[model samples]
Target chain A: MKLTIRKDQLNDAIQQVSKASSSRPAIPILGGIKFDVTHQGVTLTASDTDISIQSFIPVENGEFVIAKVERPGSVVLPAKFFVEIVKKLPSDEIEIEVKDHHQTSIRSGSTDIQMVGLDPEEFPVLPTIEESESITVPGDLIKSMIRQTVFAASTSEQTPILTGALWNLSEGQLKFVATDRHRLASRTATVQAENDYKFSNIVISGKTLNELSKLVADDNSEVEIVVTANQVLFKMGNMLFYSRILDGTYPDTSKIIPQNFKTELVLHTKKLMDAIDRAYLMSREEKTNIVRLITQEDGTIEISSSSTELGRVTEQLEVKEFKGESLRIAFNSKYMLDALKVIDSEYLFIGFTGAMSPIIIKPTDHPHSLHLILPYRTTG
Target chain B: MKLTIRKDQLNDAIQQVSKASSSRPAIPILGGIKFDVTHQGVTLTASDTDISIQSFIPVENGEFVIAKVERPGSVVLPAKFFVEIVKKLPSDEIEIEVKDHHQTSIRSGSTDIQMVGLDPEEFPVLPTIEESESITVPGDLIKSMIRQTVFAASTSEQTPILTGALWNLSEGQLKFVATDRHRLASRTATVQAENDYKFSNIVISGKTLNELSKLVADDNSEVEIVVTANQVLFKMGNMLFYSRILDGTYPDTSKIIPQNFKTELVLHTKKLMDAIDRAYLMSREEKTNIVRLITQEDGTIEISSSSTELGRVTEQLEVKEFKGESLRIAFNSKYMLDALKVIDSEYLFIGFTGAMSPIIIKPTDHPHSLHLILPYRTTG
Candidate 1:
């Protein structure tokens, strides 16, 4: 196999695939990235059994040539070392050729690197889903939706299903829900899909989904999502991302969300977040990282935290508006902070169901972003 | 204690002194900074037995003022937590007060914090030194002198003396030397001092010296270095830095530097350094991280590295001039890179003495910075 490609283009493609290449793999061949050269373009594939990433660089469109294939063949080379060499190459274009016994030689400028190559047939082929039930969504929406809910997913693997966000689709709208049992966040968006298509029960590993989310950009590009019984594929631009799905069912979090509240308050989101953050310094040393909130009759809210070893901190937040009777509530400052960061609105509405029940925090403007957090027990 | 200092000024002072405060200290009181409020100003001091830093914020000179001092007293507060709180405080001016029992209250904006403080008597006192044996030098020159030699010090404690830099002064001239026994770096400069006074054979820990160097800037300000039997003090505008001297005799490295060479070459420092850096990508997996240099008759140098398991890389560098016959040599690329980074000259002269002896590198324009690296045995 022989091919000539621009050093810059090859460097970018190599970096993307190297993210999935494991230095130490259960199977020795899994440490390499399979490179295939054809008349159309060059394709690179890398995987670690759990997550697989493949990127393709196509040939010239009109005036500029991206890559030229002298002979169509395939070989697997060491991923990490190959990427490093390509990134540091001193020339504008690089030429790669494969000889007998899978020996590969790369020439760029005055530097020539002769790397040991493995048989491409020995590398595992990542499973691709059949083109039966596929959903196409805007790349920007998926990226934003992932960022909004992925942080709420459980990082623990004891219950693997909870470690992944659940994607449910119905009536041309897609919803993502993530919860670690203490707090839950859900985001919804509309997408064009087949009229008869419906998906609700499939659950992907939250870790794998989170990794996939980072690869997508917030743009107008369209991405196709294809799902099989045990595999999921995301096709974005020139890249293909595949991950294995979790085997168990996700827990039902619908009942945990509160439907009514005794008090509701509307305040500037940024102001409240900063105030809570300052209070957090003192709360970190205390048990439960608890911060108390007291609503006064004059429509003011006071945030306070104390530690026996350190000291105490108190701050009064000026509320823009308030409803219902005056009351006091306590909750984990970190959880509330996380819930507040996802709110896209300038103003947020926080509803309390008493001192011990779960509190609902929703965007005062955008209704799709919902956050529910459990409150910590407080003493006088 | 009372003060109304600007948030930014207080933040900078806290940051500078906190460098001497370690979390895990032998004396618990050493983990806190002592703040003494006098009629003149407020002085902050932090010490960790080996080094001490004191910064003064006068009442009339700085950007902010120590607004009031109802009662003059001193108290020691936790270093890490206090710095964090002050950095994130929401107000321009912070109000601080101390109670009779060492309980301190800090208020800024709507945020109020009351932290537990310790008695100031428990804090360690900084070392006292007179100014009779003092030398004055430009802050920029001292900082540059430290940077050029400190990198060659041994990071390991196998030979404790190798971890300190030898400072020798005589007849208005000062020299700094550091080595790990494998490579050596030396820098020298002229300073203003008494004609009859001379200081020689003083060794200071590389770690402590590096920390003190950071406080000096590349400006025309003068810094006074006071040397005593057991300690060294640096007095700047309003800050005083004290460091304990290393308790060992430094080895004489003057005899190790070669006075004659078989071959020499002059080249642009940056161009040769870039070539050496590219060679590192191929040599990182090898035992010695060795890179071979070949000087040819055509004034071109070849830098290359090869690994038995990986591959090989060869790069060519153009030299301005060459003397003597063609030669081939191999050395550790990391050590060469470290030495090259310290040279301030645009052009550098490299001298080789046989293949097994140490190679010398010096700036073509500046005579202050000099480095010597030992060659590695290469059989390939």
Candidate 2:
């Protein structure tokens, strides 16, 4: 393949796909980024057997020409070397030519780099989705949904299914739920989908979700999600993100979510977070990460943590509205901070269904999202 | 100790001395910061055997009162927990009170932390530096000198002396030199010093130099450096940095610096660095970091590196002046970039004695500093 491409466009395309390139691939060819050249554009593909990413650089973008193809062919260059070379190439215009035996030459400004490439045919092909059941969602909404729920997914490989967040779709409502046994995070939103379309237990790994978030464009752009039996593809502008759904069944979390509350409180999200964040430091020193929250009779919440070796920490925060019984509960402050940081609201509605039951936290403004943390049964 | 101090000032003082506090200490008290409070101010000190740092906050600086001490006493608080707590404290004014048995209470805004502390009496006291001979130099110049020469120091513990850059202060001139056997780097400058007093072979570890660099305020302030037989102290305003000198004789590097050159070239520092930086990426993949430089007859220098697995990279750079014989030499491109990065000049003067001798590099405008790099013996 012989082509001249813009350095910036090539850099962005390489970086987007590089995340999926395997650092330690089972197959040597999997370590490379496959280059598919044609008159229309050049598509760069990389896969690590699980997640595959493909980015395309069209011949023209808007008013400027991004690439000019002299010949159409395919080759797979080392992703590690190619990524770094294009990033530091001293000129705006880069010329690439692949000669016989896959000896590829890249020239920009006064620097010329010659790289030996692998056979592109050896690279694995991405499975094409039927696209019969697909939903379109705003890029920012999808990103926010992933951020709110993905962190609660289990990082351990013991239960491989828990490593992914389940996507539940019914009617026009899209929801995501993730739990690591100790805590659960669920978010719901209305997407631009068919009214009768429904899919459940479509789980994608937390790692893949994070990579997809980066691939999605900014706020105004919309991404189309095409779900298949075992594979899911997110189609954004000029880029496609593909990942395999985690095998096995997702545990039913509906029963664990609390329906009744013994006590409920409304507090400013930032204030409560700031109070719990300070207490987290003391609890972290004890390695238990346990922080206790006690509701006072006069509209205040006292957050405290103590260890024999590290003394004690007490934080007082005033709640906006309190109803029902005054209660005391203890939970992991780290998990609490994580949930609070992503609640895009000024005020939060927190409810407790007794000390042993799960604690529910929901943003008052963005009621579609909710975070749950299991309270620690503390003797104090 | 009982005091109300500005949170920002207290945080700054703690961080400066926290670097000296050992994470794993021979004595447990060394893991804490010793706080001494007086009506005049509050002083914080920490030591890790090899290095000790102390910072003092007076009652007022300019128009702002930093600390108001209610009682005069001393106590030691755990550095790790204490640093994190003060950093996130919610109020500008932090009240610290040391009760009986070193039980310290820290209160800021609505957050209160009681920390289990160690006895201040057990903490190692910093020895008084008998300021017999001292030199005051601009903080930025010393920082720059450390940056220029410290990277060449050996990291391996095999040669303890080589881990430190040798300091030679003679006749109001200060020079720093470091080498790892294969390559050498030297930078020299004129310092404000007594003409009659001279000191040589005072070697300071690269690790300690790096730590000291972070403590130096900025370019405007002057740091008073006190030299002793075993200990060196750098006083920068309210902070005192103490580090022990390495115990060994520094290797003489004067003989390795080639005075007469068989070939000489002057080139733009940034352009040469940019080209070498690109070639370094290719050489790094080969694991040897070998980049060859050949003086072309057309007044251009060709920088290139090649490996069988990663092909080759060639960069052409034009030089302002070329004199004497045309020569070809190879060296580690990583080290070349390091030397060129600190030249502090638009044009760099480089001289080569032969293909196998130490190459001399100096800034055309700044005559005080010099760097010498040993060329690699390559078949090409």
Candidate 3:
């Protein structure tokens, strides 16, 4: 296999596929990135059993000349070192030649690097998924959805399904919900779809979604997501992201969300987040991460937390708007802060259904995003 | 104690003094920052036994209004939490009041944080050094000298004195030298001194110098260096940095640096450094970190490194100038790279005594800085 490619193009392709490569793989070939060169262009693929990514660089596309092919062949090289070498190469163009016995030579400028390449036959093939049911969504919206809900997913593996975010599409509205039992976050967006196809239980690992989010372009580019029986594929530009769906049912978090509230408080998002963040420092020391919020009769909220070793912090914020009855509630400050950060609005509306029930938070302008945090029982 | 200080001023003072506060201090009070508020200004001090730093914020200094003293008193507050609180405070000016029972209340905007303060009497006093024998030097020069020589200090604690850089002053010239047996780096500079005072065998820990380098202002401000029986104090601007001297005799490294060389190579510092850096990646994986350099008869040099698992890399760079005889030598690429990084010149002149003797590298423009790296005996 022999190919000449632009350094920047090759670096970008390697970075895209290298995300799927594992530092310590169960199979040695999983740690390698497969380079398939053909007359059309070159395709780089990497996989770690759970997540696989493939990036293609066409020989010539309009104004961009990505690569030039001399011979059609394939080989697998150690992803870690190859990526580093490609990034640090001096010349604008790099020439890679693979001789017999999988001996590869990379030359750029005055440097010549010979790397041992593994046989391409040993590397795993990309998983094939049917593109029968696919939904197209804006890359920017999907990235925002992933960022809003992925952090709420449980990191613990005790219940493996909880470590993934549920992707449900119904009636042309795609929803992403993630919960670790303590708190829950959900984001909904309108996606273009043909017919009334519904995907109810497509739960993808939060880790995979986080990686996919990074690949999503910030522009309003369309991303085609194809869901199969066991695998899901996201196609954007010349990149294909594939991940296996979790094998379990996601909990029915909709039932836990409170529909009614005893009190509702509207305040500036940044102000509330800052106050809770400071209170969290004290509560974090106590390990409980519990911060109390008390609503006064004068339409003001008091945020405070105390630790035996670290004294206490008290902050008062004037509510912009208040409704119903005044109430006091205690919840994990980290959960509140996390929920507040994802709300892209100036003002936040928080609804509490009694002190023991779950509290719902939503941006005043963005009703499509919802966050719920369960209150902690406090003796006070 | 009651005082109102600007958030930026308090934050800077806390950051400066907090460097001396250790996370796990031997004495609990040592982890706290002592605040002495007088009619003139407030002095913030922190000590970790080996090193102590104090920063003063004056009440009124022309355009810089650092702090205002409402009442005069002293107290020591936990450095970690106080710094964090000050950074996150909302208002521009923070009001701190120390009540009875060592309780401190810090108010900023609508937030109030109360922290438990330790007794100021329990904190260690700053070491007093007579300024009669002090030398004033530009802060920028001392910072540069520290960066050029500190990395060569031995990290292993087997010989405690080797972990410190030897500071020698003679005839208005200040010299700093550090070596880890295999490699040595020395830097010399002319400084203004009173009389013909000479200081020798004064070794300061490389770690302390590195910390002091961070506190050094980037401008041409003068820094006063005061040396005593067992301590060295660096006074820059309104900050005083005190560090304890290492106790031991530094080995004479002058004899190892050969005056005459069998080979001399002058090339672009960046070009050679880049070639060696690439070779070092392969050698680093082999656990030898040895890169071979061979001077050809045509006045060009070949750099290469090979590993059984990672194959090999070979690069040839054209030498701008070469003298003496052609020679081949192998050395640790990391040491050479470290030395090249600190050279403030585009071209570097390397002097080799022999294949086995130490090689000296110096910038063509800078004669005050010198770097020496020992050769590795390669089987090939």
Highest-TM-score candidate: 3
Pairs of residues at least 3 apart in sequence or in different chains that clash in candidate 1: A164-A206
Best-performing candidate as measured by lDDT: 3
What share of the reference contacts survives in each candidate? 0.70, 0.92, 0.73
lDDT of 2 at B279: 89
**Residue A250 lDDT in model 1?**
88
User: Per-candidate RMSD vs. true structure?
Assistant: 2.4, 1.7, 1.5
- Model 3 alpha-carbon miss at residue B131, Å: 1.8
- TM-score-wise, the better of 1 and 2 is 2
Tens digit per residue, CA lDDT, model 1, A1-380: 99989988888888888778887877767889999999999999999988899999997857889898899899999887788778777788999999998889888876777887899999988895788878898887888888889888998988788888888889878889999988999998888788867788667767777677777865768989887888889898889998887778889999888888889899899888988887787888775788889997678899998888778888888998798878888888998898888789999999888988888999989778899888887678
Backbone clash pairs in model 1 (N, Cα, C under 3 Å; residues 3+ apart or in different chains), count: 1
lDDT tens readout by residue for model 1, B75-161: 898897899889888887888888878999999998989989989989998877866778999998888888999999999998888
Q: For all candidates listed, what's the TM-score of chain B alone?
A: 0.95, 0.96, 0.97
DockQ of 2: 0.78
Candidate 1 docking DockQ: 0.65
Give candidate 3 regions above 4 Å deviation. Answer: B63-66
For residues A115-177, could you state the per-residue lDDT of candidate 2 as single tens digits?
A: 988999889989888859689999899998999999999999999999999999998999999
In candidate 2, what are the lDDT values of residues B1-380, reduced to their tens digit? 88899999999999999999999777678889999898989889999989999999998998889988899999999898889889899899999999988999999999989989888888897978886878888989899889988988999999999999999898888889989887777787888887577899899999999999989986559998999998889999999999999998988888877789999999999999989888898899889899999999898999999888778999999889999999999998988998898889999999999999988889999787788888888785
> lDDT score, residue B88, model 2?
90
TM-score of 1: 0.94
